[model samples]
Target: MTERTDRTVLLRGGNVYSPADPFATAMLVEGAHIAWVGSDGAAEAYAATADEVVDLNGALVTPAFVDAHAHATSAGLALTGLDLTGCPSLADALDRIAGAARTADGVLIGHGWDETGWPEGRPPTLAELDTAAGGAAAYLSRTDVHSALATTALRTLADGLAAQPGFDPDGPLSQDAHHAVRRAALAHLTAAQRRAAQQATLARAAELGIGALHECAGPAISSEEDLTELLALAAEGTGPEVFGYWGELGAVDTALRLGAVGAGGDLFADGALGSHTACLHAPYEDAGHTGAAYLTAAQIADHVAACTEAGLQAGFHAIGDAAVDAVVEGVRAAADRVGLPAVRALRHRVEHAEALDEESIAAFAELGLTASVQPAFDAAWGGPDGMYVQRLGAKRAAALNPYAALLRAGVPLAFGSDAPVTPLDPWGTVRAAAFHRTPEHRISVRAAFTAHTRGGWRALGRDADGVLVPGAVASYAVWAVEELVVQAPDSRVAGWSTDPRSGTPGLPDLTPGNPLPACLRTVVRGRTVHLA
Candidate 1:
């Protein structure tokens, strides 16, 4: 028999895109790992001694994108279930419902709509949609996936949903409750359906060049059963790398037992700016309500205290300024009671940080909190006559989405697309940061990439990735790039993927100077998982 050798493969002539240096040339991969990455001279040694060689013809190379925040299983499920993501207006939403109503034997269910996009800011009543759908039980979630607007027939079925603490039939559902119905409806899917969902979701992530995902599991949204399903899949060596976060209030330690370390998962310390439950310092301009608060200040303190005491890194979902303050005070109290060592280990976080003034941004830096934000929010909704415009008024909306402010104030920023709420495209996210609505707040592409990678990895307190140094795990994306679309320093440059196929529909004009290129391949832990 001929000699069988496990040997090296050299990838040469690629424009390197590393955090510290971008001009590095050539890399050597051996035995499912990166062996050498340096100048072209290093390649000869590999060429003389290695097993295989491939010339890149000067394409760009970088660490694979990591979606720091997303719901993996659910995202997969949504693609196969009912995608109302492209439905434009209320009329269009109802028309789609009418169509899906005829095909579905069970509940006519879908997600992804925004009342703000319609001239009428409220969803049509159940009766109105019921008439159109012939009472097939329709449920279409708002664009953010925070709330669902349902028809009478669907409401009846949702009411009868015998889940635990959620899925109430009395009124429309938001957040936790919204998740319950979604889960129940998904339960109707067969094994074939689930597998298809997982495949599509993973394929999309691969196309986006995502090597890893921060799986933010929530109490009502993702369950122990869900974790089991994912872990089983991973054991079989399938799917993108998943960094799971179990959103259990009291069972985080158990989560650690299941091989998940903390990164994020917080509550509606109040709700969202769209739902007008941001727990404002003052009331909403039009609604005249001070938003909403989930826990008492003391209760909030207890949560922080509990997490710190448990030695877990904490992250809270705070959007409105008041919610931000609540978390800040609670974090301070937890730090004081628990001591310095406890405080430093916490790395407490706020999910949205959407609507904040100067003082709040500084407080985040001062408190050592991470702004676990989704920059895509600004790119999509920060435009004129958008959600922020009507909710906060033009004057207030003008300065909204303060990514630049947070960075300038020394606050550590981490990027995530509360997935299912938004598409988990890391390239899109970097573009959003590079081409922010307010140019003054625009961050460089490197900084934005860091937020998505290293900053996220650091927040999780792991030395895992976001870098391509020796001993670092081999995780990266190979680009068949036409251009880098995250930056635009001048008018002569074009940034972002204007191609509708590159990202979710309705993507804003948010690019810096470099145009987006296609992700040819994505690999995790030395294994190729995604290929264009």
Candidate 2:
């Protein structure tokens, strides 16, 4: 006999896309999970005996958004960094850095710098960074967060990259150099400091209608602090559920021991587009440099072999076409050498398969590779003369973030925001994917939404999260977009809309005399975690 908890709630009038359902319908949430979903009249039996009945009144409803690739703590840290995200000139960036230096006493760390937007290419150098820091050591990460720009003082302490493959004597550290400094800087954060930042980030995420996050906290070497704080936070029951993805393959054993399941973290083979580090088949358009690769095809294959040997699933970062190809190559090598069963539906992933070619996408289907991509990256940076366009030029840039094509080609799709790079707003991500700048690569809202929800589960190699259905996990969100919740500040609401969900006819115009209201209530796991 099933135990009746007598805790039923009927959400009527809202249009729900069950993610797996054929169409929209109403759902009855009983306690922590959906007990039934059908016609409005079908939920009446439960409504008669329900504790609460919410009238959604024809609002668009779907499963809570899932961010498959975010840097949680890094995003939390963004709450207090010298934000240069929308600066006009290099001087503006310097001014912001100098201002931050005035208050912070410890090593000054910052993010969000793009040379493409600057008048002069990439500012002066270490001398300028040193000047901006005053006496405090400072490190500025690129907008892509794949590379770091370190001051001379910051670089003096580096010993690991003395003879590394990509190291340069006087040039700014593009890949490994910035990576080393990032690790050291992160290690400097106290546990308390990290936790506080994480909490703040969660609060903000909840406000943005994000209920769960797959935090791609970099490789294990770099993400140890982030993971520690994240696990601690989850254990303490302070915030939303955090699925940690540690990128280094060596960390697989530790993660498994830490109770990380299939679809775990591993290195695929590359970096991102903002920096020319994404391993690409061809050289960068303007810079004339072939992107960089982290793991060689053999190295990734060995890593996969390790995961298979240990009965674990693995995923990694791959941004450029070359990087996507490298992952396919590595997966092929693993399946060929390690034989079969150890892999198969483990749903191993490739983070940010942004520049995948038609051929490489076919490989994803052939090898059953899961692609965890950030939709907001394209939305915010996908305009004409954007990073991809600058790096790959018009035709190739048009091919970037080919979501529809990848799906048509049989590649499993998942969406993430890579928070810190992009704020962890699932709806924002959904909206971006729905309206990709290039029409050919545009995917249906349903397709993008599925990727945000169930696709997240697939990325984790599970059938649980990112869905709203009977027999599914009791995890979901209630958004003001469906509930008519209203708030002034979006950063305050959790599990709800950040602004009022005004029912407008179409997309809000961005011209003068018009500003869209960011209002929504965000709830998760049957709890009102955020209100707008």
Candidate 3:
């Protein structure tokens, strides 16, 4: 790795989270790589020569997080614009929109509204949205971002909107209609506005101790301009590193030209469960239909083959058993065509992968597929009485997001926030996985944390970047936390590790209801990006 700056920094007197030395209390960063990790006594040798030395004062230092899947522009817009994430009622959401409409100038773009939990049990009608926007154009995406409510004004701006599948004159738009209106709404943003939003998102990520993010952009999800600008901003080396995944079939050349790491991500095999369009094998409990399937197995096979042949990672946003089946079938078909070794070498990915089975899990491991998952989704919409159960019935819903099973079957897992849908709280994500609503689905907190950190690097085919070892990338965070605990895979095992004899490095106490660690500093590649 190239050095970002010519300087060495000594961070001592802190809990250094490193497997090389579990009881390590100090670390030395030499330019872009970690130079040493050991006891505070050993750090004295490097402190005198270091350009800057910081006494950590008992804080914990660990590898910075990597958000495996995100939509930067949309997340920024939600951060800066209207956010209906916790709006309890439909009326409350409308009132919030009305209030925002009074002050908002350009298109009123907002996100994270789920009607499934609301008393109204449905999204606002087009007329209600129009009134909330004061007859101006407005687009409010559902929590899933697979559907949205677009006012008449915004709908009118989307040429051929009515003819698209999922077009509706009264309620929230789904599928193509939602995408068209979203594009039209985003088109209202000026270049400066877009840049500000992107910057805001990156700034927020750095502040939260995230050192890297995978921007999931596509022709249907966001414009090529958005991806390019985001990549350019990250390249300035002032914020978290960003890698892009452009979801398009047969667009390998376009992905390479646009500097995308993969031609997959948000390459939809189906819609989301909340919208009752997740392409299930059986009909939804709420909706009669089996949901929508965007791509056939053969199409997925063709795309996977193309990507593998081009040496680009291929992935899909599959969230239903039917969709997961299609991905497995297709990827395996591609393996048969391109040879298993060739397909396996690329390490393809599958975003979400919420709805999976034993077969799919085995297939993922066998084919070297990474499950880029968002555990926060379960935190928000899992459990017996949650939205998943409402849509899928308790039996089917209980099987959603079986992380422990996947890991048991040897499937690679990379955790993410899918921000704007779920907030970017990495600690919360790990906690969610550890305390999964379904007890059988819960993984060890340490395992979950590793998935969010090193697993993300592995997903990107970077095997040695996320860990804190000599010669490894110096991308990490310092946190002010109450207590550190070594949570084991077996719940029966002792969690508190006050003795150095315990070989495992401890992490922040992630017991539910306890406050998460506050980021004291965030450094990426030896360059300080955020400090508080």
lDDT at 125 for candidate 1?
67
Can you tell me which runs of candidate 1 are displaced by over 4 Å? 1-7, 19-21, 48-52, 157-171, 175-180, 186-192, 483-515
Evaluate residue 240 in candidate 2 and report its C-alpha lDDT on the 0 to 100 scale.
Answer: 60
Better of 2 and 3 by TM-score: 3
- For model 3, the local distance difference test gives 0.91
Q: What are the RMSD figures for all models against the true structure?
A: 5.7, 6.6, 1.6
What is the alpha-carbon lDDT of model 1 when measured against the actual structure?
0.68
Cα lDDT of model 3 by residue, 130-202, tens digit: 8889998898999999999898988889999989999888998998988899999988999898988888888
Error of 1 at 135 (Å): 3.1
The candidate that wins on lDDT is: 3
What C-alpha lDDT do the candidate models reach, one value each?
0.68, 0.69, 0.91
Q: Which stretches of candidate 3 lie over 4 Å from their true place?
A: 1-4, 492-495
Q: In model 1, where is the ten-residue run with the lowest total lDDT?
A: 500-509
Measured against the true structure, the TM-scores of the candidates, in listed sequence, are 0.87, 0.86, 0.98
Tens digits of per-residue lDDT for model 1, 161-217: 535333434435665556566665655656666556666777778778777777776
